[model samples]
Target: MKEKFNEAAFKERLEAQTSFPTLYPFKFIVPKKSLAELKALFPNRQLVFKDSSKGNYTSVSFQLMVPNSERILEVYRKAATVEGLIAL
Candidate 1:
């Protein structure tokens, strides 16, 4: 089962822990078929990818300098639209 996510609390935590305009890392595991879609979300950013042993999924990771927690949240919100994506 998926754990519940409290957006407000997450935003608060991010604000408390992070400084603005800093490099933030994002990682996700997604089905191979969804790779293109995920890549589209972060055009021009350098993304490191690793294929799963079975070759059905790939782990994608990257970092970007963001203005604030809201920017990070916005990327997550957009990434949520990609099917079978799991953020880590």
Candidate 2:
């Protein structure tokens, strides 16, 4: 079964693990077709995309200077909206 991500717990963890204004790395694996929608989440940042060996999937990752846990969670919220996105 797929594990459910608890948004509240994750927000608390982010608060404990990182300080405000830190560089945060977001990672996700998604269908190649969803690339555009994913990139739209971080329009000002450069997203690194690595194509899967079979070329059907893409691994997306990026680092952004986030101001606080709230901002980090906001990114997660937007990311969750993408279809077939696997957060890592």
Candidate 3:
């Protein structure tokens, strides 16, 4: 027997555009303590948090609608210095 192809996943991959749309997911790691600060940093954006089992490290997953990647990078850079954050 032959394995079936994952057509849906392949289509999604092919359909991904070079330019970002109105909303997209940004996944990063941060310290548990700085989660509040991270939230404040993107007060206008919607956030979806996914907790990490690792000690002292919290996984943050959020979405940005029409965001500037430079601004996101700046936020990540600042978050990197928050004692225990390690962006994944």
Candidate 4:
């Protein structure tokens, strides 16, 4: 069975390393065709993309000033809806 997402553990880790309202960097690896969907998640932010050497996937990274753990968790939750997204 797939283990449920451990949001509490993730929040604890974030709290340890980051201050509130910090510029958090998010990264994801997704199939090339899903780039648009990933971009939709951060409409106003600039997303940096790096194509995999084989060109089947792309690595997307972006930095946004997140207000709190709730917001960060929210973004991840939304991203999880995308097909073949691997949160980094």
Candidate 5:
């Protein structure tokens, strides 16, 4: 998946050594309707939402501190097992 960055924020974060940055692209078998579940699963992670289609689907860009990769992977793995979630 392609990404668009918040350049200034990314640069600042990178310089600060606060978080490891990565582009995690996910897929959803069904269009996203409720993000509350995802939010609950990742309370401290940064999540960026985007539209994949005007009226049908969506794509989410999730950014998290590098340490959280395992945690994030846990969430993604679980979600992927669910009816609608996928990793792109």
Candidate 6:
């Protein structure tokens, strides 16, 4: 079953563990076909990609300098729109 994301708890944890304007890392696993759509979310940002063993999925990772936890949450929210995307 898919787990629900607790935004409030995540926001609290992020605010406590991270300093503002920090370089944050984001990782996501998506179908190979959805790579372009994922990349479009972070234009110009350097992204590292790795293929799953079967080559059907790709792991995309990138870092961004965000001003606050809200910004981090925003990125996740946008990324969630990509079909078959799993954020890590």
The most accurate candidate by TM-score is 6
lDDT of 2: 0.89
Q: Against the correct fold, how does model 2 do in TM-score?
A: 0.90
Cα displacement (Å) at residue 41, model 1: 1.6
Q: Residue 31 lDDT in model 1? A: 98
For residues 5-67, could you state the per-residue lDDT of candidate 3 as single tens digits?
Answer: 454564456346435434646677777788787777667766777776765666777765644
What are the Cα lDDT values of the candidates?
0.94, 0.89, 0.62, 0.90, 0.53, 0.95
lDDT of 2 by residue, 16-38 (tens): 88888999999999998988899
Q: In the order shown, what is each candidate's alpha-carbon RMSD?
A: 1.0, 1.2, 9.5, 1.5, 9.2, 0.9
User: What lDDT tens digits, residue by residue, belong to model 6 across residues 1-88?
Assistant: 9789999999999999988999999999999999999999888989999999999999999989999999999999999999999999
Those runs of model 4 whose alpha carbons end farther than 4 Å from true positions after fitting are 1-4
Worst 10 residues of 5 by lDDT: 21-30
After the best TM-score superposition of candidate 1, give how far the Cα of residue 48 lies from its true spot, in angstroms: 0.7
Which stretches of candidate 3 lie above 4 Å from their native place? 1-17, 20-22, 67-83
Instruction: After superposing candidate 1 on the true structure, give the runs of residues whose Cα lies further than 4 Å from its correct spot.
Output: none
> Residue 10's C-alpha lDDT in candidate 4?
92
* Candidate 3 colliding pairs: none
Structural similarity to truth (TM-score) of each candidate: 0.93, 0.90, 0.52, 0.89, 0.46, 0.94
Candidate 2, superposed: residue stretches over 4 Å from native? none
Better of 4 and 6 by lDDT: 6
Which order, best to worst by TM-score? 6, 1, 2, 4, 3, 5
- TM-score of model number 6: 0.94
- The digit string of per-residue lDDT tens for model 5 on 46-74 reads 66667666745556556544443454455
Which residue pairs of candidate 5 clash?
none
